[model samples]
Target: MHGEFWQLDNKNPDAKLYYKDHCIDYNELEAQVQQAVNSLPSERCLIALVAQSTLDFVIFYLAALRQSHVVLLIDAALAENDRNELLEHYQVNLLIEGNKIHSLSDYTHQLADELCLLLSTSGSTGSPKLVKLSKANLVANCSSINQFLPIIKDDVVMTFLPLSYSFGLSILHTHLAMGANIVLQSDSPMSADFWHNFEHYKVTSFYGVPLSYQLLNRLGLEKMPLGNVRYMAQAGGKLLARDWQLLSDYTHNNNIDFFVMYGQTEATARIAYLPAEYFSRQIGFIGKEIPGVELQLLDSEGERVEQFDSQGELCVRGSNIFGGYSETLVELSYFENIPLLHTGDIAIQSPSGLYQIVGRSKRICKIAGRRINLDELQSWLDALCQFEVVCVGSEDEIVVYSEQPIEAEVIKQLATKLKCHSRLIQTIVLEAIPRLSNSKVDYHALKQ
Candidate 1:
């Protein structure tokens, strides 16, 4: 039986999936999903599915959902210990690792009826905390995204991001919900083969994070064959203002829509988006809340912030919000309807009603009796150096990690900008900035 989340039965039979020159139409895809479903246990149980970017992964994921089994998506490349830890902690009944399905335990799980999917809060950090999502959450999010993004049955999307990541998973959920064709590939955007597939399949929509867009810009995006491209989107983290402007100009000149979005795993995928028409004018803003979602800004006392340009904590209320978080097996059986999700993101609203994230509430540190927003500081340093940099610190000192070594003179300049003693800042050079599978900076690794 098809899952209530995806309308596979209603999809056009001609809409197809292309993987390594092999194409399967929607009807055949459904048949495969049904066949995979037969491999899973008939009884509802907790499953830990390793999300690899492959056609088999897609089939198994949909199969698990089809069988009404609660699935916890784990990264395929996750460390063995971490992977085993999750299986043990969640007391998973079954584990789908690649093509092999291992029965980890025969003990039945008392998972919440509404809990359909569990995603890690951060794909990079092996945090045991998983975001609990219901079928309603996924369906609501897919509908909200489709309302803004012009995805149709004729559109073709390439899957370059890990299916374990929320941003990447949302792409799959949203496109399939619309009956849009998906092209599965594991190649990075920098690869010629990736672009070759893009051109070969006439892929229309593309999605990436800040780093992806930056790399594309360096690769001379304007020189690439983008004539068939319909739109491109960026999220996961803030794009530097300069990079945003560059992409905005490039997409506009090419008659391609460039979407700047803001979201979290808690909200399923998207919370707000800056429409392409407003891209040039609102370069740094996240635009506005998506359809059927409500965004509120609250001050430290929890009172609503009314003044424009005033910073407040962004809280979201929508059906797309996750059911709750599950840190252990016991938590899996419990479901709390969270009416409001405190994003813990500090933001300011422009006079035109656009919202821009200023910094994360927990990303603040006091150094030399001065409060510093690490995100803001990192953005400033990034714009100054024209490259990405990471900032981490305690009350005592701030450490700056960069791929390239910053000269002592530049350090002095940073100190001058911060109006603090030079001793408070230290620079570390690394061959590369550690990034998670989703292209997000690995702050946990850098901290270690």
Candidate 2:
């Protein structure tokens, strides 16, 4: 049997999808999906879907999955060269770009029946390394997320994040699974048009990365009209403790739920989430693992870490864990059962069983015989400067970037804090921090 990841057919027919001023109910959406499905080749093929946050994207995505086609969701803003290179390398049989669908290849490559979706690991670079996920992975994650978030039929959500990104895709999956209304738009959250639609439709929920929340906070979130907003979720990266507290206070005072989530693309979307009730107590902790997901901290020796407040690489085991990585046609023909996903993130578990990410295992650098965690340093710098800061480093030195100019004294103080020479630390001021379309910091762009 072909696995239907999203059971759109079973959803309430009256649930609406708002795009511009037009609204389509779930029954009409199902009909459109069927029409799109009928147009595609019946054989299982790798389809490259240029995912934009629009009604067409949603309809086509659901249609492709319903037909049991392997879909490679691509960012709509991906560079043409990068996009073409990926399409060729993967031997994609079909290309769905906007309202048009093109037959790219006639050769049908054999694919595992269970393999359903392929997503790029990085949003900025359009990395060819794709995470392979099956229908079970998507359904497990959606159910896990739904178990925690209080979504209802009347709830309205705005789709601002690209549907290609895992975190963004999860929002679409969980919302649609609940038969809730979704407002599809490609407009930036900074735009007046976005806020206009948000207020007009009475959008109840939205998700953002750390950078999005930081920008919103800067725009004076308290001053904005948020009467309909029931909750705000943050993921994609760690929101600084200071920023987390600021948001927690705002959400608490405003009677809105604030969820601090943690996950990677490999886990299909979310691994753990800080419940809104615990937000005030746990400022920087990623509270607990989502339902049906188990998390463990493993040391370099691959042994489970038992001590509280000790750092270890975070590991996840769940039905939601991706099948494997696929960079070639042969890799897609067979499913690799990866029962445990090593997240590459260093985390610490508190005595109360809450987990907080400290840094990435690869984000560490040594200078002057001392090891430094770039994430820790960045957090320190952010708190010190009271602004957004990004830290990247080599073996000899750490370079910090900030949108606002930092005083020389601050650099000197940071060096003193790290017990390193002032020359080893350098600061650069940029008009803005480089970010991906998903609003996560683009370290690749910054390094360039």
lDDT per prediction? 0.88, 0.87
Query: What TM-score would candidate 2 get against the native?
Result: 0.97
The residue ranges of model 2 lying beyond 4 angstroms of the native Cα positions read 1-5
Per residue, candidate 1 scores C-alpha lDDT tens digits across 1-448 of 1224344788866788877757898888889889899999999999889898778888899999888899999987688998888788878899997778998988878889898999997775678999999988888888898889888788989999888999999899887887778999889889999998889889998899998888888898877777789999888999988888888888878899988999999999899999889988787789899999999999999999999999999999999999888898889897789999999999999999999999999999988788899999998888888777899979988999998887788789988877889999999999999888888888888987
Cα displacement (angstroms), candidate 1, residue 378, comes to 1.2
Model 1 TM-score is 0.97
- Which 10-residue window in model 2 sums to the lowest lDDT? 1-10
- Report how far residue 195 has shifted in candidate 2, in Å: 0.8
Pairs of residues at least 3 apart in sequence or in different chains that clash in candidate 2? none
